[model samples]
Target: MMPCDSNMTSIVQRIARQALLTFRSPPRIGEEASKSFLENHSKLKSLMTEVRAADLHLVPRRASDSPPAVPVPPPVTYMHICETDQFSMGVFLLKSGASIPLHDHPGMHGMLKVMYGKVRISCFDRLQRSPQAAQPGALRRSVLRSTAEYTEDSDPCVLSPDRDNLHQIDAVDGPTAFMDILAPPYDPDDGRDCHYYRLLTDAEEGEHTEQREQKEKEVWLMEISQPPEFWCGGEPYPGPEVSL
Candidate 1:
């Protein structure tokens, strides 16, 4: 069932409050409080019905519905909800087969909750390199931390400053939309900027390589400009106004 829209406190408000509690103090916040905030964030599906197709301009397709000859929807779009000193909250919509490429949010914490359809997320972590081996402007070593698929029924995918900080998101089967929150929002002037990366693997490896070996493999990531293929258009939020 959809949540009632008449509530005095909107979901965005609740999210903002939780974000403040989670990020207000970086050096002094207690572990228990941080865990509690994440737990609350994971259980926030009930608060954000606006991200679903029924609330947006997109129509839900039935199984019998014929596929359109031309899919004119933008490949990707964003709906900016709100932002403060503590966090930024928004929604991203992806057309079928569209993807948000591998990227890193420097010194940021994030949560992603699917409001409709499913997405495959591949996450990675930067590994420390030996000082002697580290070269200026050379590719960095990273490990594939995890790769998983998420649907509306699943809990939000979480990331911190160190863990799962670099990842890619791909829409599966059909159009997908997800609510995203980032703490201490990106500020290029403050050295918190989004950087794009691509994973480098050994091309000589056989295609029949073992899955376990693939997971254990260490890869290098090369920083690059944003791919020309991926760009985000903006759409106005069609939900209740949030004040913060």
Candidate 2:
């Protein structure tokens, strides 16, 4: 059923509540939450499904108002909402064809709910190896664990401390937006920082050919320098006023 305007207030309230509960004990990648939260607050997920990026007022605008003011692309823009020691909430809006590069949120948990349009999400896991299992200088291996498409109607995509922690999000065709919640957001001092990466050339498929191949099947990756063309423009948040 379509959520009504009247119910939106309640829904947002519930979301904030769940947000707090999640702070107490964040949800796992596959597991929604602790069994207790799952049992008692099952209605929370439904409410989340109803909320879209537009429903909230958060909006992105150019950091400056000057013309000849360098033209910034959507891929370069990122809008961060509230952040604290426990959790953080924000919304991201992307223009058609924009993308958030493949990056990793070290030791974090997150949920992304699409608000409009569609997004192609590619997720990966960094393979761990012992000293003897692999050579020192050899490029580290990364596995393409999964890939999924999300639209406004899709459920939130979940990520945990280690699994599927590395990912890239691309806006499909039209303008798209999504709500994001991160537990204990990126803190360089605390060691929860973000890092960008590129796929390592596959020995079997060859370099360029392997990168062009788009399949979920496990593939290797090597971190490379961040692309110079990529940059984000900043804007204001127009979403519901979050207090706390």
Candidate 3:
């Protein structure tokens, strides 16, 4: 077993325990059980906090020498870790230059901890539509919303229902790895699914109201056609087997 196996086992143990607690009675996430259920799960939350890029033994390597641990622009890759009706955990490894496109998790909660190299996570908040919606033509790109970036050392991003749901992740400078956990694993029937998006750029420089000072530095993404450059290729899960 590798040194990483130790951390994997420890983290899995905590997740499994949380799974059991969640099973006894699905913890209501509102203000009611905020302390007992959510706060008490501080232990598991720390697992993500404790992990760092160096812990996974991730080192920069040329993509041509070996198969990408995750999806490349050519093929999508994913490794199975473990899954239960309540939640699922897995790891995604990206080769240098490869990226997981901007995507959304409709009705789930997730935590991502970097285990290998650095990653740039751009998060976005989705805007609500008014009851008296405007015509499609009137809904210009400017009306959509905000974006932010996160690193391994950054705080965990919270996505509720459909708010702040779309984002893209890119391995920075080199190959990278991150552990991911999604509760009530994506189910299309439940209206929880993943959808990809690309940044909406200002096509006509002076055509639209420009907010260069506020907008140039800020990433305003528009849902455009998916690019062929983004794709994931699968690799082996390097962690200990997780069982709950």
Instruction: Say which candidate scores most in lDDT.
Output: 1
Give the per-residue lDDT of model 1 (tens digit) for 74-138. 57888898888878988898878889999987777788878788899999988763354322345
TM-score of each: 0.75, 0.75, 0.69
Candidate 1 matches the true fold with a TM-score of: 0.75
- Candidate 3 residue-wise lDDT, 74-103, digit = tens: 433566677877777777777776778877
Runs in model 1 deviating more than 4 A are 1-7, 27-74, 129-137, 204-215
Question: lDDT, candidate 2, residue 132?
Answer: 46
RMSD of each: 6.2, 6.4, 6.1
Q: Which ten residues in a row have the lowest lDDT in candidate 3?
A: 134-143
lDDT of 2 by residue, 138-168 (tens): 3545778778999988988877777778899
Between prediction 2 and prediction 3, the one with superior TM-score is 2
**lDDT (C-alpha) at residue 6 in model 3:** 48
Kindly indicate the candidate among 1 and 2 with the higher lDDT: 1
Q: Which rank order by TM-score, best down to worst?
A: 1, 2, 3
Kindly indicate the candidate among 1 and 3 with the higher lDDT: 1
